[model samples]
Target chain A: MNIIVCVKRIPKTAEADIFIEKDNKDIKKDNLVFALNDWDGYAVREAVLLKEKFEGEVIVLTVGPDESKEVLTRCLAMGADRAIRIEEPIPNDGRLIAETLAKVIQTGPFDLILTGVQAEDDGWGQVGVALAQILGIPHASIVTHIHIEGGKAKVRRELEGGLEELLEIKLPAVLTIQTGINEPKYVSLAAILEAEDKETKEMTLEEIGFSPREPLDATIDQVSFPPTGKRAEILKGTPDEVVGQLTEIIKRKKGS
Target chain B: MSDIFILVEHRQGKIRDITYEIFGLAESLANQQGTSFTAVLLGHDVKSFADDLSRRAPKVLVIEDENLEHFNSVLYQKTLSSLISKYQPSLLLMGHSAFGMDLAPSLSVEKDFPLVTDCIGLTFEEGKLKATRSIYGGKVNASVSLRESKGYIATLRPGIFPPKMHGEIKGRIVMEASPLEGGVDVKKFIEYIEAPITGEDITQAEILVSIGQGIGGPEHIPMFEELAIRLGGTISCSRPVVDRNWLPKERQVGISGKTVKPKIYLAIGISGAFQHVTAMQGSDTIIAINKDPRAPIFSVADYGIVDDFQNVIPILKEKISDMK
Candidate 1:
């Protein structure tokens, strides 16, 4: 089976700090740190799992500028056989990126394509499904488990109320993996060395037969931390006094 | 004026709540822009829900297909793209639920339109659609505006928009035959495994007592659970609790877990982080108990306690039990 996994680079949760731009009240950017998106890690892991079961080449693809290579290399080190980077900073527009990725994925005769349910940066979980739409393939999002047998693929997706729906699709389909689907494998020293020599194919918008359209003019005007609240008073007293104070606090705070 | 399109979601003949919420949002946007609101439903026997939807929007389009009874991206996109070609809506709205997650991106790619997901709010500004969404999980909020003349598509986060109220605005329902274009074929539904039932629906629980790494270990869970039971609420935890295998993934609340909107949310020993807060910030009231006064959770919390959860939870549980 030929499988492809899509990954993205995002600001790391712990390192990201959002600040409003002076000129725009609606725009904000993080100045601190960035890393591979959490769910995309699951996508890469699922692809690696598929390769382990089906014995096929896993191609990890990311659409972004130079900064995205970090995630592609991480995917390579994580066991993807090869990597492809779309050498352009796809704008905040989800549609443009989906179109570019759809075109790129169509070039390969892939049996299945996997992507994280959403990027942590924008939390737009729609990209994988949108790519599948453009590619004209069966697609499922938030997939927690999957198994490929014969020519059909069986997938379980998490839904509301702890309910899961199992779906079956033919080969050459798309699926967006949700987190907790599988544990991402750590990059071994040997694998990192092997990935350093692996060939990475770079595709330009022109080469992919698509022109960069004006980014969906979505501009972040400002970013601000939510307001803080009053400090909690720690009631320290005799056991009886503490109990009385605690009861008052709970009644006043929780209203129960 | 440009038309606004909304996708109606349903399963087993029952309409999803997000569907109504998306329609409510679309109705508001359409009324504000003085444009028509068109609802498109794709599924088997989905036409039955159109009558109910007509009360919310100006027009309804039902594209019936047995293949679409379940969410099939291939069929939905083919049908949606055909509809888009027929009626070029200026903006398309969908619920940012599991189905929307699967369908929105694919439709955007097929139609070559700008798409945004997990939007909490939307408004038109200076002839452009402006969307507000959280960045870095829920640590910060950002407002974004769509660029040019191309159509805009977005998926609204659930619970952001309130449910639409019933009214007397009757509309028309247009039944469109399935386009049935060539796309990926869905074989069948293999099986539907319901996640093992937990005690309560934490996502809908009005009160949630969430535990963090500060809870010591698995043995300490009963203390929080006792409080939850006494309060007639449910118990949840941060990613670390699930990561430690102390709680099942279903009991976890964060970016990777379920988004909830409880009336009262209590955090014990949990440091507020963007990933963890985004899933629970919609709660009506938030209370954080952590030893570190600098814990970020205090930022959005309505009440904060600078103390150890271990010492606090047992006493609180006892107090609640005594009150009962």
Candidate 2:
């Protein structure tokens, strides 16, 4: 069963100070470190594991600028057979990304397409399903477990509140893999260097037959810090001083 | 033809909270825009659901079929596609839950409607749809404008909108059998597996020492457990800790986990993803101790300490002991 895994490059914003650029169109990139999207780690790993078991080719695809090649390389180090980076900046709209990827993916024949449940950046959670719709295939999102047998698959999709629904779908489907689906293997720098056998292919929008059937429907007008209506009072001091204040607050508040 | 429609979501014979929450927005928007607002209820043996929804909208279109008994997005797309074409509602709303995430994008593509998912803020200015979406792991909000079109679609994050119901006469209820003629040849629904809830109920605890991925590894959980005991609290954790099997599902706090509102919620080493924050923000007091000063948790916390958990834990224990 051949597979296509969609990986994304994202800013490490969970622990960083996100600064909206002055233009208000995107986040400031200068102060942030970027890595493969955390959820996409499981996506690439799941693809590689499936390839190992089924003895087929695994392709890691991403839609971003040249900087995204690094994530593709990392996916290759994680044992993906090849990488495809469509040379375009990441778009704010999920539908456009899906369009770009679908056009490229239609060029190949594959039994399955996988993507992270959502991007850590926008958390739109739309690209995979949109891509599936564009390709006219069945799709399931937030998939926690997958078992492929014959030409069909039995998959468990994670619903809210500790519930999972088991569903069976035919092959040539799209699944947005949820986290904890598997333990993503660590990509070693040595493996990154030794990924000589695997290759990263770059493509332009023109090459991918990029033509908007309809104009993009949504545009991110501006970006800003999340409203700080209930912002916390930061304890200013050494660890001892901060701990003194925290414990004091806890002492008064605990069991209140 | 240009109106508003909200997909009424239900599970296990009860209307989900998000459906109500979205009603708060859908009804008001429809009133302001002067377009008819209808609620679309799709399910089998769910007439009561429609009856309940009738009060929320001017009209409730309940499309029932055996295949709709369970939410097969495949069947839903086919059914909703025909309904959308027939009604030609200008705006459609769905909850950004497991259901919407699975359905909205595909509908947008198939319908050629402008799509926005997981919007926390949605409004129409002069009949143009705009939305506020959280980006960068919920650290930033991106304001978006949907292109002009006859049809527009948006998904509201479940917890963002509160449900509104005006006191008035019930609206009309229209019943329609599912239009799709054939069965779902692909994507068959099996059984729903509910993880057995076991262990301590952290939701009841007055103080919760919630650990996140920042705690490093499972080997360190005992240390946090000890800290929890010292603070007279129970040790709960974020989704990642549970994902790593460091803690049981019973101890997880997030959208997919338990919604916790302890007297004093102590979030340790948690960056405060919107999922975790949404659950615990109702706590009487939220104190976040994360080394990352910009962790989103700090924004919701009553007090915050930008320091290493390891260093803060010992001193916190000592200070609490002295105060006691």
Please tell me which predicted candidate would have the highest lDDT against the true structure: 2
Q: What is the C-alpha lDDT of each candidate?
A: 0.76, 0.86
Docking class of 2: medium
Overall local distance difference test of candidate 1: 0.76
Worst 10 residues of 1 chain B by lDDT: B181-190
Candidate 2 displacement at residue B213 in angstroms: 1.7
Residue B198's lDDT within candidate 2 is 70
Write down the C-alpha DockQ for each prediction. 0.43, 0.79
Model 1 C-alpha lDDT per residue in residues B193-279, reported as the tens digit of each score = 755655566887777889987777899888778788898789999976775677887887875577888878888878765557768
TM-score for each prediction?
0.81, 0.96
Q: Write the per-residue lDDT of candidate 2 for residues B1-324, one digit (tens) a residue.
A: 377999988877888888888888987788788777888998889877877787777789988788888888999889999999899998889988889999999999999999988999988886789999988877788999988888899999877787775547488998876788867878889899988867788878988999999988888788778778877889999999877778887888988888999998899889888788888889999989888988888889999888888888877777766765
Second chain alone, TM-score for each candidate: 0.80, 0.95
